[model samples]
Target chain A: MAKILIVDDSRTSRRMLRAILEEMGHEVVAEAVNGEDGFVKYKELNPDLVTLDITMPVLDGIQALSLIKKHDPEAKAVMITAAGQRDKMIKAVKYGAAEFITKPYEKEVVEKILKEVLAL
Target chain B: MIANIIANYLINKGKISLDQYYEFFEELSKVRAKLGLIAVHEGLMTEYQADTVNMLQATMDMKFGDLAVEKGFLTHNQVQELLRKQADPYLSVAQVLENMGIMRLNDLDLLMKKYQVENEMSSSSIEALKSDEIDRIVPLFLPPEADEYVAFATLAFKTLMRCADNNIFPIKGFFAEKLDCQNGALQFVDGDPCLTAGMCGDGNALLGAACKFGQEEFESVNMDALDAIAELLNCICGLYASELSQKRITMELYPPQYDDTIEGVGEYKTLIFPMMLGDKLVNLLICIGEKLEFRYS
Candidate 1:
C-alpha cells in the first residue's frame, strides 16, 4: 500500500479521496489545503504519492508539482482536476506529474491510476 | 420542468386540485414512451435497430433520432416523421386526464387556453417547452437581459440532471437583490469579466443530490452533505469554464465555499431559478460582472 498526501482546497474532495484511499488499503499520511501547502507538506512528509488539485489559491498544482519534483526528482505526484483544465494538465505533465485524475472521482478509475502510479 | 410549472400554477390558481395533479402525472408516467420505443412501434425501425441507437446514445451526446440517422438506420425525413409522432409531455398529461375520466377533452382544452393566457405565454413558447430542449426552455424562465448566461444555465441544468437527479423540475426565474437559504455552495469565475454562481436550498433541498452524487446516505444535512453539494457546483463551473475556453476566453475558478447561515449579499442583482427536487425546492443563483458580499444576521 502506498502512503499518500492529498492537496485540494475542497474539503469534500479531500474527504472523498481519503475514504477511497483508505478503502483501497492505502495510508493517507497528510492533507493540504492548496498548492503552497502541498509543496510544504511534500517536503515534510515525503509521501510515496501526492494528489494535487490543479485550480487552487496561492499556488496551483503545476507550481506545486514543479517544486516537489525539484526537491525530489523521483517524487510521484498525480494531478487532480475538473474535466476542462487541459491547458493546466499539459503544464502539469511538463513538471513531471506522474498521472492525472478528474473530479467527481470515479472509484474504479482512481484505483487503476493509483496502482499504475505506485508501480512507477 | 414545464409540466411541473404548469401543474403547480394550476393547483395554486384553483383550476386543478393537488390530488388531481398528482393523479395526472402518475397516469402520464405510465403511458409516457421514449423516442426509440415510439420509433419501433411505428415500424420505422426494427427493435434491434432501436436498441443499437439507444446504446449509442448512452455513450454519445447526440439525440436518438440524430444517432439513428448517423448509424444509417433511418433517414432525416423518417427521423423527423418519428419526432412528429413522439408524444409531447403536456399533451400526454391532458390525454391521461381525459382517459382517466378526470376531465373532458373540451374542458381540458379550455383549461390549457386559460393557462396560456394567465401566464402570458405564446403558443410557440409553449411548444418550445413541450420540446423539452434545455437550451430553448431555459431562456423562457430567465430574464431576457440575462441572455448571455443562457449557455451557462443550460449547462448547469444538464449537469444537474446527469450527475445529481433526473427528476428535478425547474420553475420560472427572476432577478432579485437578495436570496436567503439555509445552506449553499458558492464559486467564482475570475478573468475578463467576473461571474459568481451558486446553489442553495432550505431543509432537504440538496440532501437527495448529496446522497446521489456522494453515493452515501446521511440522515441529515451535515458537513459531508454540504461537501457533496460543493463538488457538484465545482463540476458545473468546470464545464462552463471549459466551454468558455473553447471560445478562447480564459477564466480562473475559485475553490468552492459553503456556509449554513442565511445572508444577504451586497448590491449586485442575482438571477434566481428555483427548481423542485422531488418534494423540496432548490435555487440556482447567478450574478455577473461584480463581486458579491453577504450580510449575516
Candidate 2:
C-alpha cells in the first residue's frame, strides 16, 4: 500500500479521496488545503503519492507540482481537476504530473488510476 | 411543480378549499402514471417491451422513451403520443376535483383561464408548463440577457431530477442584485467572462438536498451536508463548463466552496431561479462577468 497525500481546497474532495484510498488499503498520511500548504506537507511527509488540485486560492496545483518536481524529480504526483480543465491538465502533464482524476470521483476509476500510478 | 403552482393559485383565488386541494392532490398522485406504463396500456408497446425499457432505464441514464426508441420498441412519434396520454399533474388534479364533485369542468376551465391571464402566460407557455418541460418553462422566466444561461439551468434541473429529487419543480426566476441565504455552495468558472453559480437554501432545504445527494440522513446542514451539496454543484458546473468548451469556449472550473452563515446583499447582478424540491425551497443563483458577494441577514 502506498502512502498518499491529498492537496485540495475542498474538504469534501479530501475526505472522499481519503476514504477511497483507505478502502483500497492505502494509507493517506496527510492533507493540505491548497498548493502552498501542499508543498510544505510534501516536504515534511515525503509521501509515495500526492494528489493536487489545479484551481486554488494561495497557490495552484501546477505551480506546486513544478516546485515538488524541482525538489525531487521522481516525485509521483497526480493532478486532480474538474471537467473543462483540459488546458491545465496538459500543463500539469508537461510539468511531470503522473496521472489525472476528475471531480465527482468514481471509485473504480480512481482505484485503477491510483493502482497504475503506484505500480509505476 | 406546475401542479403545486396551480394548486396554490386556486387556493389563493378561493377557487378550491385547502382541504379539498390536499385531497385532490392525494387522488392525483394515485392516478398519475408513468409514460412507459401509459404506452403499455395504450397498446403501443407490449408489457415485455415496457419492462425491458424500464430495466434498461435502471442500468443506464437514458430516459425510458429514448431507450425504447433506441431499442426499436417505439418510434419517436409514438413516444410523444404516449407522453401526451400520460396524465399530466395539473389535469390529474382537475379531474380529481371534477370526480369529487368539488368543481365542475366549466369552473376548472374558467380558473385556468384566469390563471393564465393573471400569470401573463400565453397558451403555449401554459401548455409547456403543464407538460413539465423544463427547457420550455425556464426561458419564460429569464430576462433577455440571462436567457443565454437557460441551457445551464435546464441541465441543472434535469440533473436534480435524475440524481437528487424527482418531485421538484421550478418557480419563476427573477434578476436581483443579491440573494441572501443561510447555507449554500458556490463555484467559479474562469473564462473570457467568468461566471459564478451556486445553490442556496435554508437549513431544511439544504439538508433535504444533502440527504438525497449523499444517500444518508443528516440532522442538520453541517459540514458533511454542505460537502454533499458542494459536490453536487461541482458536478453541475463541470458539465456546464464542458458544454461551453464544446462551443470553442475555454473555461476552467475551480473547486466548489460552501458557506453556512452567508447572508446580506451583493453588488453583482444575479439571476435567481427558485425551485421546490419535494416540500423544500431551494434557489440556484447565477452571476455572469462579476464575482458574487453575500450579505448575512
For every candidate in turn, the CA RMSD to the true structure comes to 8.9, 8.9
For candidate 2, write residues B92-122 as lDDT tens digits.
Answer: 6555665677774447668778878987879
lDDT of 2 at A86: 76
Clashing pairs in 2: B263-B295, B263-B296, B264-B295, B264-B296
lDDT of 1 by residue, B1-297 (tens): 656666666677786787888876777677754566556645678768887987888899999889999899888998888778657665565556656666643465577677678768788887787677778888877777888778888899989888888767777788888887777787887877888888888877789988888778966677678778888998998888888899988777777777767564545788888887766788888888876554578
Error of 2 at B26 (Å): 11
My TM-score estimates for the predictions, one after another, are: 0.78, 0.74
Write model 2 residue lDDT over A1-120, tens digit each, in one string: 899999987776787788899999999999998899999999999999999988777889999999999988999999988777778888999999999998778899899999999889
Which structure among the candidates has the greatest TM-score?
1
- Docking tier of model 1: it is acceptable
Model 2 spans > 4 angstroms off: B1-118, B214-217, B255-257
Q: Which stretches of candidate 1 lie above 4 Å from their native place?
A: A22-25, B6-30, B33-88, B91-101, B104-109, B218-223
Each model's lDDT: 0.80, 0.81
Q: Specify the CAPRI tier of model 2.
A: medium
